[model samples]
Target chain A: MTENRRYRLTAIAVTLPTLMSATAFEAGASEPGLPQLDIATWPSQLFWLVVLFGVGYLVMAKMVTPRIGAVLEKRRQTLDGDLEKARTASSDAAKTRAEYESDLEKARNNAAEFAKQAAMEATKKAEAADAKVARKLADKVASAEAALAKAKTEALANLNDVAAEAAIDAVAALAGIKTTSSQASKTASSIATKLAKQGAN
Target chain B: MSNSEGMHSPVAQFEIKPLVELSLGGYDVSFTNSSLFMLLAIGVSSIFLISAMRRADMVPGRMQGMAEMIYEFVAEMVRSNVGSEGRPYFPFIFTLFVFLLFGNMLGLIPYSYTFTSQIIVTFAMAAFVFVGVTIIALYKHGLHFFSFFVPAGAPKVLIPFLIVIEVISYFVRPVSLSVRLFANMLAGHTMLKVFAGLAVMISGAGGLAMAGSLLPFVALIGLTGLEVLVAALQAYVFTILTCMYLNDALHLH
Candidate 1:
């Protein structure tokens, strides 16, 4: 319906001038010649030309061009702002990442240091325990040596008494003279004492 | 020229009947169909721009898109031809471009008068551009602006001859610019009217001649399309030449 109305309006707009011209022709008007070549129409055409051009130039310069320029400028500013924000955000992320990596590296170094210190402490404790066990073994070796020396002296004394009894029996048998057991024991003891002294020397 | 009896005369279309006869100080400043169409051209351009830019969205709709396209097209022409210093004259160039474009295109409408076909109108515009640019050059460069008519790198003997040629060519700028547009429009419309008249004449004979009329009818259709292109191209030519002239005026070489 709007299309029909628009067409009708256009038809009227186009035909109205033709209809008027036709009526003018019937009213006995002189030939206007070529409208373009008509000298009389030049002044009016020039006049309207100046007027319309002045209006167009003013409107475009004052209103249209400035508005379009402003819109384009606004768009440019918005774009630049968004880009700047993105750049700063990315830089911030990079900074945080660096901080995190450095913190992780420090933590790892701390853990390594702790482990090294623990190993050194454990080695020191083990060395101290080993020294105590070695000292105890040396003390037991010294006591056993002293006990063996005392047992050898007691055995030598018993052998000397047996030798005296044997000597008395032998003298009786060989000499055919019955000597006293006391005398024989004395002699044997004396011999044994001498021998023992020589052995001690 | 007033023979509107059968409405088939090719030349009758150029008649300028007064719509509102007015007189001012013994001058016949009567408003004619030429004035009306010129007014229509202005009105159409204004309405188009106003409506197209009413919303002025960042992402433009169709009308806004067209308006921006025209705006940018003229802006680019000015920038490329006239350079950055030409920025101040952008509005004037843009106005002239749109005005001529609408004037030429609207003339293509059936039963509508084409103001650009008039030599006076085109000459008036060209004279304005010529005078305006010369004034700009004079204001900017003073005495050096006259040096524009002296060709650079000319031998001593050829200097006088070269200057005359340069001066003549410089003065001819307005004439050539106006004639180029006016002639193109006038010829194209006249050819279309002639073919249309042929078709009408042939078909009115009836029977076998009516079938022959189809040939001219087809040619008429083709010419109409060609005329539309010519109209747009002529407008572009006129505008770019104006920019080139402005460039020369500003830069002088």
Candidate 2:
């Protein structure tokens, strides 16, 4: 619709000059309304206006516009790069967190297992030490008992010899007896009985 | 001529005549008020900005702050439309916006010429934009820039007609663009001047009619405010169109 309006407008504007021309020829026509196109007079002005516009345009489009577009493009790239970096960093951090958590769990489990093993080994060593000490003590006690038994046997033999000597002396001194076998036998019996009585007393 | 001469009254009785007329090689060169003001506009703009920028500090004073604000405003405009890709063109766009803004504002000063009021000046600027965009489109797209004349999804059989319409529209770009800024400035300023003149004339009559003059006085105040808005709008329109042209050059769409 706008395009059609513009077209109609253009047609009217173009036909205007021609219509004015005919109207002019019909009028007094003393003064020419439109001046003849004088290339020398006005085209120079138009030319310079164009030249100025061109220079201005070049400055804007070539120099100015491109710089602005560049800044925008650079900004876009920077933002994109920053976003990617953030994403990668986040993913890396997540992976590291997961690895650390798993390693920590593994370390805790290993520590618990090691502690249990150490405790069991300590208990076994303690038990072995107790058994060795008990064996040594039993051996010493048995040796001490054997020594006591030997000492007792020697003491008894000494006591019997002393008793027999004393009896022989007493008989010989009391009866002026000869050292005869029968006398000796009787004396031995008496002595044996006396010794038994003494032992009893 | 009678209509124009009669229209000159109710404003200033003063008229500008060429002073120090010198026809240099058959070109009528005269230092008229218009020429003087054109030079004055250039000088004033240069002096103010240069002086303001002279003692530019990281922390700005009033003058520097104003200058910086102008720079920032134009910079933001370029940034928004052209995107960061358009940063380098900041100077041209900035200059165009500033010159037009200053010209429009300066005319609002008592007894100052409005250069933008003249079609020639406005058209010159628009022509510059039109030519610049064309060159840019061509340079960027090469022969492919011609493809801009063809609309997308346009049927093949209708191609020729669309091309003609496109060409005409393209040619009209500068005319419409230039006239919009020029016509708005001229019309608004002229209306203000006429109303103010009426207010002065009516109050001079000095009666109940003079009491009635306060209405125009109030309207003048209102119009002044509107003119400021229009001035800014004109500058904005000029800058945005430049951006749009730049957009076409870059995108070829």
Model 1 lDDT, residue B232, Cα: 89
Which parts of model 2 are misplaced by more than 4 Å? A1-201, B1-22, B55-65, B79-89, B139-142, B207-211
Minimal lDDT window, size 10, model 2 chain A: A32-41
lDDT of 2 at A159: 58
Backbone clashes in model 1, listed as residue pairs: none
lDDT of 2 by residue, A150-181 (tens): 99888765656665566667768998755654
Q: Give the docking tier of candidate 2.
A: incorrect
Off by over 4 Å in 1: A1-34, A135-201, B2-7
Give the alpha carbon lDDT tens digit for every residue of B190-215 in model 1. 77887987788889889988999999
Candidate 2 clashing pairs, residues 3+ apart or interchain: A68-B84, A68-B85, A68-B86, A69-B85
- In terms of DockQ, the best-performing candidate is 1
Candidate 1's DockQ: 0.25
